[model samples]
Target: MDHDHTLFHRDDVVALRHDLALSLRAAAHHGLGEGICNHFSVMLGGNSGLFLINPHGLHWAEVGPDDIVLVDERGERVAGAHGVERTAMFIHAAVHKLAGKTCVLHTHMPHATALTVTPSGKLNTKLSQNAMRFHRRVAFDADYNGLAFDETEGERIAAALQGADVAFLANHGVVVCGESLAAAYDDLYYLERACQLEVLARSMGGGLAEVSDQVAEATAAQFARDRDQSRLFFEALRRELPLP
Candidate 1:
């Protein structure tokens, strides 16, 4: 997995590293990341068979561009000062390879993980405008075998995605994927918000008001057309945070 560090210095690759690091910091800031567990990854440009991931042992709050580890599809460290976590390797590499996602974000954020443990085992997309944005874009994995200890487990999780951009892993966390980091991160943020609202609403003792499928689908499409907002939101994060 060792490679010339020179190749990692390409302008686009550097930018991706910065953006991924900033995203980790943002996730930490927003309480989307747990201790040193959840991982985020981005495929290296142009089908390079490599990706950047946060090194193990570093909290998301302190991750920086240089802390991002470059690894091959097999999860071997190609260039970095630290080692890759075992679950991160299996999960992220499989998602990038099997799901063909350019950006893969996995987190155990409180609200979303709370939904995963419920009987419904997935988000109720009809519950809120934020949830509506995820209508028809979510897949559910009802089986919770255990931790992803190997490649097959990772592949199973990827297969569960079933071409959807969001997946709620039974008894686990959630995975959010997108063609770009900004778009995926946007989904991650709002997804947690939606789930938080649902949890709060359920606590109020009244039946949840639901939106019709037709309305949810239309709302999703409307949100889809505002893709620029994702980019702008990420830009706003960069402006507000001390990322450099």
Candidate 2:
């Protein structure tokens, strides 16, 4: 496939590349990445049918702006030096298309994946303040049909989201989607923290303390109103990381 040099060089596209690379690096820094398996992607801009994703075989820590691959809806690599991972194409493409998510982040970070393998099957949003941020904003896919080797599995997973921003994939991993890279990464980072807290609480062997539905809903509303915080958090990551 021919490369779109002009599109890649556009200022907004360049900035998005930087943001995506920074997000991958930050996820690795926070130990949220699992080798080269998990993937992150962002739509180019406003349903352009093109998106940016990290190439296969590159560790998240080493992915730079130039390493982000441009992939079209058909799973073809429009640009970048390396090929897209099969699952990355299937899962991300379906979510981008079917779910209409602008940014999709899929990971198997330990604490969150831990919850997936449990009988509870999802996060307890009313259990902790951090968890409250996701109140009524999570979906669960109880069916784990193995690796997404094709589009059908991907569509199934996307449909499983059921209009929620976060999805807990039963016995597999977690998917976090948002309107932008900053927003998605913010949710991914905090989701792990919330899961970590819950897992730790469970290990302590006492009855867990959960807040009332009214309190959880109120807290989530407050978080929803403070959308700028997600942008600020991503900016902080960019500043802290050794990106150039």
Candidate 3:
């Protein structure tokens, strides 16, 4: 488990570090954090399989740019702190290595977690336009094997992603991956909105009103073709929570 020095080169290093810190702060602001748990990581570049992660046990608010650590795809901490979070190594490292996802963000946000504890633990896709966007995009990992502290568990969770960008972990929280930090952050925001709307709508005791399959498919397609707006979305959010 030796660290690779080549992975720590200066290319895009500052930007990645800033974005990682900004997202953690945003997570804290949006109430996506649960104490000092969960993790946000971004792959440095293609093929290198090197990435940066927030410090283990550092509350989201306290995770500044200098606090992020570097690790290789094999879950080895090549730079920064002596140890990274076990679950981060298991989950983020596995997905970035196997699935080639650039950004792997997991959060135990309230609404997202609520969906996992339900009987089906599925995202109610028919709830809203936000919900419809996840109609065919949401992946579910019904096997809640407690905390992921090893490579095997990480592999299982990555397999569950099944090429999908978002996953709802039953009895747990959620994982969302994207080709860029911006895409991942945008999806994370919309997903929380989708889950929150569904939970609130269902809790009213008035049963549920759902959109049709055709509309859902069409709407999801619209979201899929929304790649151009992802930057704008993340920029807007970052603006709302401007960092010094």
* Top of the candidates by lDDT: 2
Candidate 3, residues 107-159, lDDT tens digits: the string is 99899889999997978887789988788778888888878977887788889
Each prediction's RMSD over C-alphas, in Å, is 1.1, 1.3, 1.8
- Candidate 1 stretches greater than 4 Å from native: 1-4
| Count of clashing residue pairs in every prediction | 0, 0, 0
Using all chains and alpha carbons, the TM-scores for the candidates as numbered come to 0.97, 0.97, 0.93
Model 3 error, position 12 (Å): 0.9
Instruction: Estimate, for each residue in 1-244, the C-alpha lDDT of model 2 and write its tens digit.
Output: 4556679778999899999999999999999999899899999875568999999999999999999999898889887888999988999999999998999999999999999999988899999999999999999998888899989877988999989999999999999999999999999999999999999999999999999999999999999999999999998988899675
| Candidate 2 error regions (>4 Å) | 1-5
Comparing 2 and 3 on lDDT, the stronger one: 2
Question: For model 1, which pairs clash?
Answer: none
Name model 3 segments beyond 4 Å from true.
1-9
Instruction: Give, for candidate 1, the lowest lDDT window spanning 10 residues.
Output: 1-10
